[model samples]
Target: MENNQDSRQRFAALVREHSHSMFRAARAILDCDADAEDAVGEAVLLAWQAFPNLKNQQAARCWLLKITVNCAYGQRRGQRRVVYMDDLSQAAGSAPSPEPSGLWDAVLRLPEDQRLAVMLYYYEDLPVAEIAKTLGVPQGTVKSRLSRGRERLKALLREEEAYGF
Candidate 1:
């Protein structure tokens, strides 16, 4: 069908435009990066299948993020094995430790609402209103989450990285 062809093209374009957003949502919702990848991948597939229902192309990013988050949440609900990255044995103390992983460890320690808010606000660079809409919460809730999350990160990261500097 001509409509199907057009929809397919539009869907592909939207995916390219919002891939990073979907990936970020997946990463925040799923604990592990690999699981996040899987979630994003699954979300893309589901989005394409549901493309006909999308009325406004401009809404694609938010729509995709919703799918990504939902898919990651679903995966989390069904998963039991905890991913403990620290357990991986690195070669002898020859190499210095990584930085970003430590930061992420602190981020991951946050409560889910706070983690999601911080990620959307800082990483995604979304405003409070947008975050509130995406999260189905009030703007005030977003502000509180960002405030508390930032304070906690300041404490945790300083303790981890301050000794050297």
Candidate 2:
């Protein structure tokens, strides 16, 4: 019982430390904020169950994110598309149009592999090798994905600008 308590405490600490990044990574994949939160919660539960098998403390971030990505993908499966209705007051009011945060919408339009790689490497600031391990791909593949993602993002953003978006 004491050992279990210790494990729980350790897991809690790790979650507190890394949960934000995990949520962001999940959000990048899943799009909706609510789904991102759910994915992180599910990942924490799974991580708690498998914490004993985690050999390296240093690898906790990667491990937790791996679980988050898996859970996000699982959650995405069989989920129907949902369109949210905007508030009538906000919609009807002459509110100033918010400027787009550069390249974010374009990033969202990227293919899954490239999107994940770009999010992990650039947004999460994780090293390519670690990202490769997390994604179960080679370092070369991670690099290629990053390259392709960047190229695609540039093209998309330029097209948006040219069309006056």
Candidate 3:
């Protein structure tokens, strides 16, 4: 019981430390604020369940991040092509366009591998090796995905601007 309490405290602290980044990654994956929140919540649950397997405290953030990304991707994957609607005020009047659609839209359009790489790299500011470690993929794969994803995003943004997305 005491061990469980200790783990929960540790987990809670970790969540407070990295929740923002996790939400961003989740939002990036799912492309909706609500779903992102849900994904982060789900990831927190799953992370607690798997906390027994955690080896080092230092890897906690990355581990939680990876879980959150996977959870967001899983939710999106399960229900593909379902659009999330935001406020009419944002779409119609004020609210000031929360996040640049081109950036998020392009990121959302990326393939899973590339999207993960881009999120870990740009959002989390993780090194390639760390991303690879979190993703359990080779550093070369991470680099390739980052390169391709960035190129594709650039093209997509340009296309969006040209075609008015």
Task: Give the distance in Å from residue 85's predicted Cα in candidate 2 to where it truly belongs.
Answer: 3.4
Prediction 3 global C-alpha lDDT: 0.84
User: For candidate 2, lDDT tens digit of each residue in 42-62?
Assistant: 999999899998989999999
TM-score of each: 0.80, 0.79, 0.72
- Candidate 1 per-residue lDDT, tens place, 70-153, comes to 898888899988745554444333454565547667787678878888887877777788788787788998899999999988
C-alpha lDDT (0 to 100) for residue 153 of candidate 1: 85
- Alpha-carbon local distance difference test for all models: 0.80, 0.86, 0.84
- In candidate 3, the residue pairs with backbone N, CA or C atoms under 3 Å apart (3 or more residues apart, or in different chains) clash, namely none
Model 1: which ten-residue window has the lowest total lDDT? 85-94
User: Which of 1 and 2 is ahead in lDDT?
Assistant: 2
lDDT of 1 at 51: 84
Better of 1 and 3 by lDDT: 3
CA lDDT, candidate 3, residue 60? 88
Worst-scoring 10-residue span by lDDT in model 3:
80-89
User: Clashing residue pairs, candidate 2?
Assistant: none
Q: Report the C-alpha lDDT of model 3 over 1-165, residue by residue, as the tens digit.
A: 348888888878989999998997887677668889999999999998998889898988888988997898789888756644556556777766633566756787788778878988997899999888877889999999999999999888888887776
lDDT of 2: 0.86
